[model samples]
Target: MQAWGYVSHQIPLLSFASRLMNKLLAERDFSGQEICHVLLNCELQEGTRVVRAVDCRPYEQQGRSLRLQGDHDDDAEVVGIYEKYLSRPALHGELTYLDFLANWNTSKRDGRKWTRWSRQAKPRVLYYFPRYKSNPQHHQYDDFCRVKLMLAHPHRDPNELRKINGVEYDSYASAAEFCFANHQHPDDYYGTPNAEDRRPDPDEFEEEFHEPDLLDEDWLELARQLPDCPPSQEMVDLLGRRDIDIQYDWTPHVGRYADPGIVQGDYWRQRIAQNPLYMDVEDLPSEARDTLNAEQRIVYDTIVGHFQCESEEQILLHVDGGGGTGKSYLIKVLSSHLQKLARNRPSPIWRAAPTGVASNQIMGTTLHSLLRLPVDRAFTELSPADANALQNKLRDVRYLVIDEKSMLGLRQLSWIDKRLRQVFPARAVEFFGGISIILVGDFFQLPPIANKPLYFDGPLKDLHEASGQIAYRAFNYTVFLQKVQRQQGDDQASFRLALDELRGLKLSIESWKLLSQRVQAKLGQRDVDSFVLIRPMSHTLDPTLPHFKFLGKRSRKCSGAARESCGQWRAL
Candidate 1:
């Protein structure tokens, strides 16, 4: 194989024929040695280009017989021959070598035996010939091609030139034949006196090839046409300019705007018209004076004094109270008094709560809605229009009352303070925009979700210090509503004591036993009918229990009646 490597292409055609003869004999199960002539018919048109392979055959020279015989009138011409010694089988079986060869040839002609050489057509060849732009010698090829093609067809339109010259026919042969009359030399064509006159001027060519200048206005128009393209630099700068007063027409969002149903002017007007003399000091309602407990009276007096004070000092008050301490009743009295005082003018009192349900109970709105504060962003991050709107909203509001302060976080309180400061720059910087703000809630009620509470003195103090925000220090006055007005008598006294112990996280054995007594396991039908279950431990009662049906059905009916009857008994 090594020796044959040097002349591998020049190997004799008889070698390939001998190999084929041996393959054929092996395929036919032949074993003895035999000399045979093999002929391969290949059709070639021009020179060495093979058009197709026509046929193959093996002939026994001594016998003068063809192994694979067929009609000889075909147009395929014999191209070569291969003659060598090949193994042939002895004549023992019914099917001989001749019969096998005949069958194989028949299969090949019938299109069953397909060999690589027997393909009907050759594979297409892709030529990597030199294009005008790629050839270094043809640096000016594009210009030359365009000029020559145009001059050759002088009567053709501009559109026709683009269609035929650089784009349609990219070959140099096409350009030369069309323009130079088959002349191959580019330099000679350019040097010709007539061709020199036809050549385009360099200055004109540069001008024609240059791209158009795109101005800012042009780019803006283009951006408008193509929606996906971002705004250009010039447009962005114009929009970002502070001097441009871009008055945005903002729509009031549902949660951000106070409920129209509650804040309408007609509701306040009706209340004022119904009681024209309520604002007179002599006509003060007896309910305001009689209903308030001792602690609640102190809170009410502090709020009224703050409003009555004519000094520049702003008061920030927080009323610390637990559930059923008359905080809501106090708020109602303050609201009535403030509304009556400002009946001839705009209302000075603005009540807000953190939750919608609480806001509705106080006949006010959510704190976020009243101040137009964004739920997802901080007050400092408000847009110019939003900030201005907030300032206007806070301008006339003199008394701001925030209920349910437990659910509000330190950051939110700081945000409110910041917004107030922005609105009233003339007020003392220490207080909240010179407005008397009353915060009412128990810190232990419900902690703020995902943030630190107002009185949180945990490890997060450093975070508040870094932000330069004060939480508990903002309040100038604090009032405690310690009396439990809702509970009384021996049973109520015991219940209140147990609740206080639970709040302190110190559950006494007696308290646990008192709570456990309410959990009755089994009861008879008469007990179920007579049993008055006050407060169940769980929200869902055990439906499987025998007493559940009667208790569930009668408890709601009895509880309201029992509450009314219990209210009649007061502390001696």
Candidate 2:
């Protein structure tokens, strides 16, 4: 291990970040309660006990920080706490916490609360976690940054970034990372230089590096507006509601470097359910490929062929299976084919899911929420705000795998169709690749929701028909991952038997057992969940502009944390 000298604030930041990250992965939570317990103990056992519990990000020249993400001064009830408590160095990570006293002066005043608008306001933190940032370079390591930090854990109050076993300490722990890809690490030393080692090469850039420009207004404004990082529960609940799976990535270890670089002018085209999943032909086997029946191959061929082209157009795929069938398993398997085409790596067909739970499957939004349209108090069909929001994020996605298509109806089918058309010109454009939409679900398991379905009465009559224009052309491509997820005993025997049994009546396979056994020793439970929520990364940066900056990471995309691409921002 390299010997350390002192606990410069810069160094403490990284070690603290790494330790906290380790806890987030290990304990699966970042709340002060959970984090503080572990980090504090670790610090005490190791001996550093000084800590400053401030949570403010320097937003102004004098270091005034604004309310983090959710609290909005735009709303009134929360104005008091929002103004006083929100941006302070620390405040329970919320206006209030369990078993704690309320801190706002907007007390009952006369016992009875006032109006409806007043009820809407509260001193609660609004959470906003970004689902996916374009991850151009996650596999490469050339852009990693290093800093020092102490082992401390964060509590809701003073959520410090580092911690030890069960105590709180302040002395620096180890390395931390700060990134400025396209720029290298600053040459200035934060504190006194290491005494043992002689200064390296030529003119030391002593004056060149100093405290990071803490008063950059643009930088501060962006930080103030960054969507709040949502808690895990919010994320999981959202995805589960939409049937999206979830996964976490914590490899970078240090602070900002752990996740991929997300710039202001960008938005994620898809979710990062997991590092793209892959499949090896060696493991899948040619014999296995040969054994697939014609009907099965037809499904495979259409789906497998989608990636051969490059476009942003729309495509819809539908697969039907019976109860007990492995629709989800099949979705995963088929995803491999698409995954191979999506990324340059040899990993299996990747189905990048979302970190944030979403209401809508496509863009990590919710359903009822996404359905809001352009009608005001006048009445509209879908949510224009939501659609526009989605457009910016999903404009570039080429492949779409909609699991549970069997549960879809005509209205949804039409809504999605029309939406896709609106975004791209005649599907004939190669740049659109006729956006592929794969619908996988066991119709036998359940049918589409009634009333609002395509098969409903009223204005949606043409929607529910099997002979309508949509019926014939809805899913040009379809495949059934007929194999179940958890096929216990004899997989081949059971797979064949299950299909044979359902030959007449609807049937399905659950591939959980087989899948678990297949990668049990490798990936635990699951890492990548396709659930997502998206918003424009840069309110100012246009979606169409080509990559404008580079900081770290290997690829041109801003990734990792190096010291480059410093002056990349331009006012829109």
Best by lDDT: 1
**lDDT for each residue of candidate 1 in 223-303, tens digit (9 for 90 to 100):** 788758767888787873545435653355436636463577466666668875221222347366567776666666555
Candidate 1, residue 406: Cα displacement in angstroms equals 1.4
* C-alpha lDDT of residue 16 in model 2: 51
lDDT, candidate 1, at 571: 13
Task: State the TM-score for model 1.
Answer: 0.42
Which segments of model 1 are wrong by more than 4 Å? 1-286, 381-385, 459-471, 520-572
Local error of candidate 1 at residue 46 (angstroms): 54
Model 1 scores a C-alpha lDDT of 0.51
| Cα lDDT over the full model 2 | 0.37
Over the stretch 1-572, how does candidate 2's per-residue lDDT look in tens digits? 11122333344443454465678778764466667868676542232322212222211212332445557656333223223332323333423211111113334422233112234333222121111111223321111111112111223332332333344434222212222222233222222223222333334323342322323347778898888986798776586345333244434543763334344322343344434322222223223434444444445554554345332234454555554455443444455445544556443232322112311232233322333322224223336675576565455455555544434555455554555555544463322235665554543323343313222222323332422234424434334445443453673765656444544343444544444444435554454333243332222212111211111111222112211122331111
In model 2, how many backbone clashes occur? 109
How many residue pairs clash per model? Answer: 0, 109
TM-score of 2: 0.29
lDDT of each: 0.51, 0.37
